[model samples]
Target: MSTLTIIWIALPFFVGFISYLLPRFDRIFSLGVAIASTGYALWLYTQPPLKLQLLDNFGVTLLLDPLSGFFILTNGLVTAAVILYCWNSGKTAFFYMQTIILNGSVNAAFACTDFISLYVALEVISIAAFLLIAYPRTDRAIWVSLRYLFTSNVAMLFYLVGAVLVYKASHSFAFAGLRESPPEALALIFLGLLVKGGIFVSGLWLPLTHSESETPVSAMLSGAVVKAGVLPLVRCALLVPEVDPLIRGLGVGTALLGVGYAVFEKDTKRMLAFHTVSQLGFILAAPEVGGFYALTHGLVKSALFLIAGVLPSRNLKELQHQPIHTPIWIALVIASFSISGFPLLSGFGAKVLTMKSLLPWQVIGMNTAALGTAISFAKLIFLPHQKQEKQGKIQPGFWAAIALLIGGLFLANIAYYEAYSFENIIKPLATIALGWLAYFLIFRQTTVKLPRLLEQFDHLIGVMSLMLILLFWMVLA
Candidate 1:
């Protein structure tokens, strides 16, 4: 099992390194790595959980528990679809190299039980993602990637400080070390994770960064990369069950705020990016079930971003009149509807779990976010798809989109396997109906402009800092 874990973490890094020597086979190498990692994750999931402690004196360890296994599966599935989509396209060898390296980083991040190793994995993921985001070499791409680099370094720095505090308080940096730690310390750490996880104010950078990056990069960003910050929080919640209430508060806050912004956004990728934040809120709201919640959301969100890659326009209004190819249209609606928690889909199950044990207000907040999510997705599923008959010649990357949708649905249902109760089926229908009405009545013609100052780098930093201070006050009060 340890050997397999090593293979799971090393194979992508090894393939990526060697691919530089044989650039001619970059596509083949990348495809092979993707398929292998994805298949291994799916297979490993059915087996028992495993953990390998390393450097116990320093509290460093590796984990393949159900939480890690579930997220690893999510990462692999998204990477497989991305590699397939990028195949035969004219991406540079550097693109494949960075992408594959990031794949390794995400796997390692998910599997590590210690903060030291997890932080290392996240830093590597950041560098690789920065390179991939800047792959186009355009001025705007470089600019966005730079912002990503800056924000990531800042957030990780906070995380390191928080980890140091943890070590000071409890004499360990492992998940087990979090016991008896101060709330101020945990709050500092959660704030850092919240920023990288794209939650609320700390995540304000996400909309611009994701919307500006290339489509494939956007898919990777919102889908796999964002999970770097999320799983650790899940681990913390598992280890320190006292923090569950805090996690719930953050999750509900993030869901409502993100979906509110997404409802009025006009850009296709931008809107989905906000939804990424929103869906993550749902995942966080149910920390107990967050493994599968994150898995299902990650897969569906990745599919949606990749579909946006092939669209003719990023503007919602423009897409409304555009005649989409029929099959592509179906792919769009399924992924959209799935994310909206439509009946019998992956989201429906995930959402039911998210609603479990919520307080009255939390439940109301999450449900309202669900309604907003439905309205936001309705823009894609209903608007300009009326042409219905335009069977234009299949575009490039079309089949890859279909594969992603089908694969995501299959994994969520088969691996996660949440049963459909009568209540689960009936609840989302009312939200869906309300969403439709709200979309037509209120959100359809609404145009909202967020304060520009809030999006600036200094402002984003200020918000994070203020959050840390507030967290400290709350913890100490």
Candidate 2:
């Protein structure tokens, strides 16, 4: 088991290095590595939980329990899909290298049982993501990547300090050890993870970062990387259940704010980015079932971003005149409806799980977010029919991703069948209907401009600092 764990962590980086050295076969090599890594993770999922002490005196440990196993499996599958999509997309060798490194870093983050290891893994992932975001190196892309770097660094500073505090308080960095630490330390750590988790206010950098990058990069960012933050947040929730109320409150707020901004978004990618924030709100509110939601969102949201990438234009208004391929069109529609919580899709199951423990008002807020999501995506159904243009066949990787995502949607239903009742399924359908009505009544033919507060990096940093101080005070008091 230990030997397998070591191989799983090292395989991506090793393959990435080989790809960098042999640029001619980077795509094929990376694709093969991804398939192997994903297959290994599936095998690992079927085994009993395993723990290995890498450095006994230093307290470094690797643990693979059910939760971590689930994330590792998701990471493997998403990375494979991403590699497949990028195969024919004209990415350079360095792009493959960074993707591979990021894949390993994410796996490491999920598998680590200690705080220091997790923090280091997260930083590695962040650095790789920053480089990937800046790969296009356009003026806008560079600026957005820089902002992401700065914000992520600040969040990590919090994490580092909090880790020190936690170690000082508990004399150990393990999750089990931190269970009894002071609330102040836990709050600090949680705040740091929240920034990465796409929580509202703290995660102001997410929308631009996710929307501005290349489509494949955006898909990975939205689909996989953001969840890195949430994984630790889940750990925090387990250790410190007292924070559940605050998490739920912030979750609902983030959901409403995300969808509110998304409804007015003109760019297709940016709209999906905002919905990422909103969907994250549901996960935060229901930490108990958050993993299930994250898995579903990661798959469907990645497909949505990939579909956007394949489109002729990024603007929703221009889609009508664009000659979209039929399979791509079907995939886009399925993803759009899935995200909007249409019945019988993965999103429906995730939404049901998210709302299972919510209070009445919280449920109302989530429903409203769903309605906004529907309204925003309703624009896609109006795709203008144009004569089919002669185009090359879509790659097998693209088809594979779409099929996996659609399959994931149905599989979620089967996996959580006990959670699905007539009422639960009916609610999402009703929500979609209300969303369409709300779209016509409120959002149709109206343009709403978001305030520039979130766009200002300095202002966001200041707000984040203030929130951290307030949280500390609340805990200490």
How big is the positional error of residue 196 in model 2, measured in Å on the Cα after superposition? 1.9
Query: TM-scores across all candidates?
Result: 0.95, 0.93
- Cα lDDT of model 2 by residue, 1-477, tens digit: 788778878888898999899999888877777677667766776789898888675567887776765566667667778887776777899999999899889888878878899888888988999899999889988988888888888888988888888888788888765567777777778778878777887877788889989888898888888888877777666657666666777788888888888999878899899989988887877777787788788888888888787788888767756767776777788888888777767777777778787767687787777778888888775566444578655555787777766787777667777656889878878877887887778776677777767668887688778779767775665
The segments of candidate 2 whose C-alpha lies over 4 angstroms from its true place after superposition are: 320-325, 359-361, 392-397, 473-477
* Local lDDT at 159 for model 1: 87
Off by over 4 Å in 1: 386-395, 414-418
Candidate number of the best lDDT: 1
Model 1 residue pairs with clashes: none
Please, what are the lDDT tens digits per residue for candidate 1 over residues 91-176?
87889988889989998888888778888998998899899988888998898899988997898899898889888988878877
Model 2: which ten-residue window has the lowest total lDDT? Answer: 380-389
